[model samples]
Target: MSTRLDELVQELGQADRQERIELLIDLARELPPLPDRLAGSRDESHRVPECQSPVFLFVEPAESGRIRLYADAPAEAPTVRGFVALLVAGLDGATPAEVANLPDDILDRSGVREILGMQRISGLYGILRRLRALAAQLPQPESPAKMPADTPSADPPSAASSDPSTAAASTPDPEALIAALRTVTDPELHVNVIDLGLVYGIQTQGHEVHVEMTLTSPACPAGPQMIRDAVAALEKVEGVTKAHVKLVMNPPWSPDRMTDAARDELGIF
Candidate 1:
């Protein structure tokens, strides 16, 4: 581990859940403003698609073989912004080899994983993955024997139906759709949103499917990603040609919305 990362882990290790959250907010506030060149640019290439927040990042080799990271996350998404800030503080100024050798479970050692949730932690992993990829582009010493386990696979498992007979079916199976939706998880909570009671309703007309859902918070950084995942999950269902997700905040979300299983996992007795 980098010295900075080790220090951070030790600092955060002493805090309780709520204190960890406060520290994250403080880190978010301390995040440096983006450089003018990359700020507000619409270059899709820099965007981290895995993040639900509109986060964009880039890494470049700096003087003395150091690496510099630049990132932008919306102010509304403090959790995401804080995470970005954490990465910047931890890995900035580190050598390429140090970055490339970062352990996949680095975040797990931070002592804030439970408070940050699985989704946010997962997005943090995505940021690290991008950083490593950028670092790999520059000339370096012999690569590590093993890559980080959390690095996303190039070939995602196919969700398409294997049976050709079911491929053209026009009716979307409600059960199958539900099952597919179940596959989409809340990265932070490590629980399916369905079990969290995020899905308010699901409907299908012809081959188009519509889903109504809400997030744990209106300002959830993972909101957009969750919505996209929901749509993608639905589209993978047999007979669903299109998928639409409507995010609702009228009723809001509360612990009561969670299913017994979710509550059990979260120890919400």
Candidate 2:
């Protein structure tokens, strides 16, 4: 199976122009605030000089026996912040070996080159180089023979496992599936597919699910990405084994289909 970073790369790589931008902004908002304990560590030694924005990063072993990354970037530089956030999310809690082995073309694989200018792209690579350097400072994990039998796993528990509504459901709940789908946003609208009324129907059979959905238009560039995202969301449900997404333009999609909240966000009133 692919690592979390690989999944993120595939998602960004498949996304349309508008969706990519929106996803990056969403990631920027998720960058954890630098903890007070590391406040003074923001010196030039920890900074990425190639980036126009002042960016600082630190890596350390976590209590869980995995790794943790802390970073700081100006709010004005959402693009930079977003890239940092992606690295942090994908690599945090990962084993040191995993971080060391990450591909150098990770940024290029994410399709970010199409979105950023050449200078910004160069700076992003610099950030990657700096992060790897910091991660290199950590002690490597010991051999299994030298470690305890109860060592913590590198992968974290899924969000679904923590939620009673999904975790305890004997069968896959349509509502749970819907909740998962809500995570998938329309690239152009920046509103979730659920709120946009793109999903026409959902059916569950045993551990499998089938969904019928539509796009804003047949020509919409972001349609494929939205479909892929929706499928990804559904499969994340606790009881779901597979998710099948079918595109249907027969009913089509319209502004009137948008929920009140989506309308408000778009100033559609």
Q: Judged by lDDT, which candidate is best? A: 2
- lDDT of each residue in 1-269, candidate 2, tens digit only: 12888888888889998998888899899988989999988886677877778999888888655788789898898878887888888888887657645666777778887789666587786677566545544665752221112323233444654566765665577678888988999877898888887775676545656677788889989988888898899989978877777787743455544645322322100
Q: Residues 38-131, candidate 1, lDDT per residue (tens digit)?
A: 6867465676656677788777778877888777888898877877787788888887777766666656666657777766676666666656
Number of clashes in model 1?
A: 5
Ten residues in a row with the worst lDDT in model 2? Answer: 143-152
Query: Model 2: runs farther than 4 Å from truth?
Result: 142-269
TM-score of each: 0.50, 0.51
Residue pairs in steric clash, candidate 2? none
